[model samples]
Target: MTTVQSARGPLDTADLGRVLMHEHVFVLTPDSQRQWSDEWDEEEQVANAIVKLNELAAQGISTIADPTVDGLGRDVARIARIQAEVDLNIIVATGVYTYCDVPNFFAFRGPGIIPGLDDPMVDFFVRDLEEGVRGTAVRAAFLKCAIDHHGLTPGVERVLRAEAAAHLRTGAPIMVHTHPGTQTGLEVMRVLGEEGVAFERVILAHSGDSTDAEHLGSLAEAGFLLGMDRFGIDATLDFESRVAIVVELCRRGFSGQMVLAQDAACYIDWIDPMFKGALPNWNYLHVLGDVVPALLERGVTESQVDEMLVGNPRRYFGG
Candidate 1:
């Protein structure tokens, strides 16, 4: 059986039904939360995450592929605590999420500064996939990294290569935070391809942020799983445009190459709370409660939606 690691334990890939490919239990700045925020209650946040995730499970979502890695405040122990209560699977990742510089911890240790040393990130990420996260037995099911509008800077290149290497080592799939606006997915294809990583093994996240179906179609044609995720984060691409793109892609017969998600977190302190309140539909429920219905109304078939939600993810995980 093709088994993907979950927070609870190993899960047969066939059991990963109706997955949200990109979601976070929490997206935090640990330093900011520790020193600046006055309202972070540990127990309350855990309880809140439990509530949010359970509600997602009630929607018939069998799994959530959380890409919350090192830079995104990945607290697997706390996630483990929350998973004990939720009914669905929470498959976590291992990688650095940096658009620019590598974290100080890795700054001078890798080849970036040392010139001839192996990237410690590869070992660390491999350990997470092979051994377990930190000291827990919950192995990471996938690898994650990013390249934004900043393009392939040295730091971003470092993390991407490390993640690609880890994938080649462990056979874990990778999700890259890409900027479709800058046509960054093309750069991602070039980079990971050079590292000998197959395009099918990589997910170009946030491809839905741009409505340029030609660019997205090219990436999909190239065998990259387009993450038509980020539904409900309307400031970049509004609800109608996001749903319309999916319908358009499905019409073009690329439903098998797309995946859906809200990319929602229970509490992400990135935006001001006041600003976050403006994104009324930016939650775990928005994709199913709103986007899916919208896609159906726009003439996308239920089978196509299932292909995106179930088949694509299962294939990506080697089910």
Candidate 2:
């Protein structure tokens, strides 16, 4: 049986039931927070995360694929701490997160920047997938990167190429944060396809944000897994529209090509606390409490929901 790495340890893929394919334990910019934010209380935050995750577990979600990697402020040890107090499987990831440029750590180095150098991120990503992240036993089970409305800039291309290289070496699946409004998923297919990465193994995250079923269906036809993730963030598309798209896709017979999630986090330092209040339903429980019922009411079958919530993720992880 294939095994997937969890925050606590390795688990057989069969055990990853009803997974939220995208979620984060925490989203922080440690440098910025240290310099200017006082909203963070480490002990309290960790306890709060424990409460949140356990509550999710009680709702019958067996696992969550957290894409909080380097650019998103991933802390493996902190995840391990949270996992210790919760039974839910937390599958973490590796790779950078940026819409335009690679992080400055990668800026001056790497292949084209220097005459004889190789890109270091590929090695780092593969190491996380095969070995362990930062010497911790919490190995990354997948690779993550992003291309946004900014399109594929030099740095975005670098990160995608590196993630593709790592996927080639380790057979790990990939998840890309794409801006569907700009149809950037096509660029991902062209680039990663060039690297010989399998389309089925890559997830086009935030696919639900765009209600164009034809645009989404084309990607599914190309064999890429569609992440109907980002359920709670209604600022982009409202709740009814989000549920409607999934119903239409399921009707069109692409249920096996999709996965679901809220893209929620226990705490995110990106938004101002005052502004965060406007998104009352943007939390970890949105999918279980709201989206699923809506999908059912819209005539999405139980089997289709199971495919998106369970079987698809199992296959994505090589179950």
lDDT of the candidates, in the order given:
0.92, 0.93
Model 2: per-residue Cα lDDT over 220-265, one tens digit each: 9999999999998988899989999999999999999999999999
All candidates' TM-scores?
0.99, 0.98
Q: What tens digits encode model 1's per-residue C-alpha lDDT throughout 142-244?
A: 9989999999998999999999999999999999999999999988989898999999988999999999999999999999999998998998789999999
Task: For model 2, give the 10-residue run with minimal summed lDDT.
Answer: 109-118
Superposition TM-score, candidate 2 onto the true structure? 0.98
Report how far residue 154 has shifted in candidate 1, in Å: 0.1
Q: Candidate 2 clash total?
A: 0
Clashing pairs in 1: none
RMSD to the true structure for each prediction, in A, is 0.8, 1.0
